[model samples]
Target: MATFIALVSALLVSSVYSAKALSSNYYDHTCPQAESMVSRTVKKAMLSDKTVPAALLRMHFHDCFIRVTPFCLAFLLGCDASVLLNSTSKNQAEKDGPPNISLHAFYVIDIAKEEIEASCPGVVSCADILAFAARDAVSLSGGPTWDVPKGRLDGRISKANDTLQLPFPTFNISQLQQSFAQRGLSLDDLVALSEFAASLQSVCPMHNKVKNAGANMDTTPVAFDNGYFELLLQGKSLFSSDQALLTNPKTKALVSKYACSQEEFEKAFVKAMIRMSSITGGEEIRRHCRVVR
Candidate 1:
């Protein structure tokens, strides 16, 4: 009985030590130190206000519309070249530049992260990197400061089906509410999530010019601001998706609030943005976040 007890004790000690060693490695490999180094370089590029990298815009193209509910990761962006090359006519390809929808937003977030990964070498979670990048993008567009929580795990799958879940440029506010609801999010979540609009640059023109209006979402078209809501107040929103805020009485009240003050939107946007970030790794963010220590 003493021999048996001694053997068990040795195994337990060994197991604990092994776990400690593995955790240390993961902690360092996914540490902010490495990511911060890369973030610093990215900041230099921004502080100088240099022309942004095309790669940064390209990161979001592949996973724009993925939802938090039925997880899918369908390839939605960055297929322009292939689509064009395979097109039957020159005009046909030019009319459409390989679209899976405008992933311009996601691309910017990914680019910032790529810079960090290059500097740190597997030390930061892309999920955390993306969260920070989003905050940066919003700041670049003139949004408020929000701290990004670190230590999120990276996910492994890169499914394309999930991409289909994101809202479309043409979706009305009703549809948007339903979409968010599908993900277990509330209508309030939709409004708050839309606050990220302040950080966006003009949206890519939809293939159909008639549909491209108001799709930009941001008033600055370059900086983040409450211009979107003001536009709503003026009844000048560019797309039904946006205009619906003013048109629907239930949602219209919120539009009036956003129109009345940027402060209102910012307050709501940050809280919701945090929630959206927390939904990581269903598909769009999985390959970047879900990394468990």
Candidate 2:
């Protein structure tokens, strides 16, 4: 366990420290319509599937977690679109990895990529598209929105085994702290990011065998509010990792504060999202999100 944590910590720290700078106007001249194209795609998809927002958000989180290590690190390739790659007979991609099996809404990225490629052609990167989609998902769900820093390059290598390094749902408070700390995130960031847990629980409850056995993480799952924090105060969170938030005084107080004020929660959430998503690395902009160019 110690060795595992150490390895994860190294990966997290290195990825963040080696990140490249991104800009909100990355595609202004090249693809001015990129953000709008992604927003429309995500919005259109959500009209049929309410789960699209949560799925896209989860996809972004997952995509940003695993970095292309040691070799790619030299080239600054963290948070690349490695997660978008498909598994081949010789090698399994990160998407096929055990931890990513439940990650959906990848097709949303594909559709957005197609639209952007049609207009811009080899201009915007898949990594940036994922970031835009995540931002759109939050705004469309009535959450706060921000101008996403773009200009990420897509990574060329993705190994299924690397996904195992991601934090697990059953991680204890100490482990969770180490995981976030390695990424240079504070307890406040952890609490804010925990909002994603509520979104996940709303789509899939704990131990439900029924197909589409969706349960509400809070009273207003569709509204992207701080109801999750309120529910957490009631011991209503389903994941042990989330319940662990209350174990520490600092995080517990944050949870209480967010529960009492939706504005505080939204603010913290947006700040954390931008900080988290900004951990960037990749090689080249992939022509197709699913395959490297």
Clashes of 2: 3
lDDT of 1 by residue, 1-293 (tens): 53343345334333332321112234454444644553454454444332232223223222222323332223212111111111232223211233343333333334555665565555555545554554555554456767554444444333334444456668876677665544345556566555444224333222322222333423432455677776667776556677666556767888677767788778887776554444433212222222222
Which prediction has the highest lDDT against the true structure? 2
Q: Tens-digit lDDT track for model 2 on 1-293?
A: 75456466656665555457788777888999999999889877776666778778878888877763433445334568888999888889999899889788799999999989999899999999999998988887777899898888888888888887677889888888776665556678899989866854575333342232334322333566788888889998878999999998889999999999988988899888887777777879889999988
Estimate TM-scores for all models.
0.59, 0.87
Q: Pairing residues by index, what is the TM-score of model 2?
A: 0.87
lDDT of 2: 0.79
What lDDT does each candidate get? 0.45, 0.79
* CA shift of 185, model 1, Å: 2.7
